[model samples]
Target: MPTTLPVGDVTSNGRTWRQSYAEDFTKPAALGTVASVYPGMGLYDGFQDTSGLGTYAPAKVLSVADGNLDFDFHSEDGRPLVAAVMPDGYAPHTTARVSIRYKTTVTDGYKFVGMLWPSSDEWNDGEIDWPESLTLGASPRPASAIPGTYANRHVKYDRSVQVHAKTDTTEYHVATTEWDTGIVRFYWDGELVSCTTEAVPTKPMRVTLQGETWTDHGAVPTDASGTVSVDWISIWN
Candidate 1:
């Protein structure tokens, strides 16, 4: 199993990749507060409104221990407390490969997502989401948005290319996404599960791991809670 980033070149899908960034969370620490500046990796530790269903209070939801980064989600004051973490300093990539080893507890009304989001924060620019689940235990899927699809304050994309893998979030799995010039590929446990060119994003983007709650699907119960653990993450460009 890959517990850490490759030291040198890594070969995958007949392509050579050089590691550009990685995090194993070996350093144990507590995220201070919302928007607190984490020294290592320049990580933004704080609240985020990624899904608009909850608040991402990293100080309350995130922690590093025993070489793993954990996201603990629960309700506070009738509002769900979720988590999101984004790395800084590394320039967004136009073409890159990302691998993450993670697992999650099956919790109703919650979702986990690993995505490459447009650095410009423009919805029309494009986005790539892999190993994304609308609810825990459901099959994971890869979804992408084609550039210039934003209109009337809503985002749309080609759903024809979306595909899912028969895997559960309770078990640790290495999920990977390869974004090339005009195509994107999704892999689970090193097996290709989906490939799409229709909604492949062309603009530079950065990765974010998020724990989200649901509002439309169902209201998150006050007692709903779970933890998402990431053993490590690696990025190549």
Candidate 2:
């Protein structure tokens, strides 16, 4: 159930937005338990290995021993990655904001935490891919690729914006996206990074969190592997 309790607030332009959804990740059982995810959240398990192994099992709930849980994403034989999604979903044209507190130790793979419409495949949908990093080309690339950077029918007229995090992702930080009807703003630690109105998504999108190895995206897999820990996710409107 969505609770009405106060979690946090974000103020912009003299208006304060109160949190509407909060996932504090408090798993009470053992680690790696295959239990239901946080309220209003959906889990996406990846491809099953044909060698008698189960489906992609990169996601797990790790007890912080402090009465809280951390969603951990690690590599498994360099195959399918894992992700968590918002089941109810959010839409454009609403004065809303979603924020995630997370950190990653993936130095040579991909990690993303934001809100988008894509699930297991390409929907060509617009995305607020904040606080994301991918190491593909000769260097690392931030998720805020130029709007219309993707080639697909759905993105032909897409308009979006993003910014690189100046802080190391190994440390916890808050990444947020504030969206209205015409503009979407990306923020890091309450600091504005990018704001644009181009190709902003018109469809409802789910909050998405993912961690994967390079091989999952057709790139060669290195020995590199790590976890992306999400402390909490909150929304305001």
TM-score, per-candidate, Cα-based: 0.90, 0.69
Report, for every candidate in turn, its global Cα lDDT versus the true structure.
0.78, 0.52
Maximum-lDDT candidate: 1
Model 1 bad stretches (over 4 Å): 1-4, 31-38, 41-51, 88-90
lDDT of 1 by residue, 152-216 (tens): 98777768657788778888889999988878888988888878888888888988886788546
Error of 1 at 71 (Å): 0.3
Query: Global lDDT for candidate 1?
Result: 0.78
How well is each residue in 1-237 modelled by candidate 2, as lDDT tens digits? 122222777677566886676766665535545244333455555554322222345345233433334444344565434444453343222456777776666445444445554433345545656655663111112242233346654344323353455666766667777766666777777777667777465545556554334434454334444556566677777
Clashing pairs in model 1? Answer: none
| lDDT at residue 233 of model 2 (Cα atoms) | 72
Ten-residue region with minimum lDDT total, candidate 2: 136-145
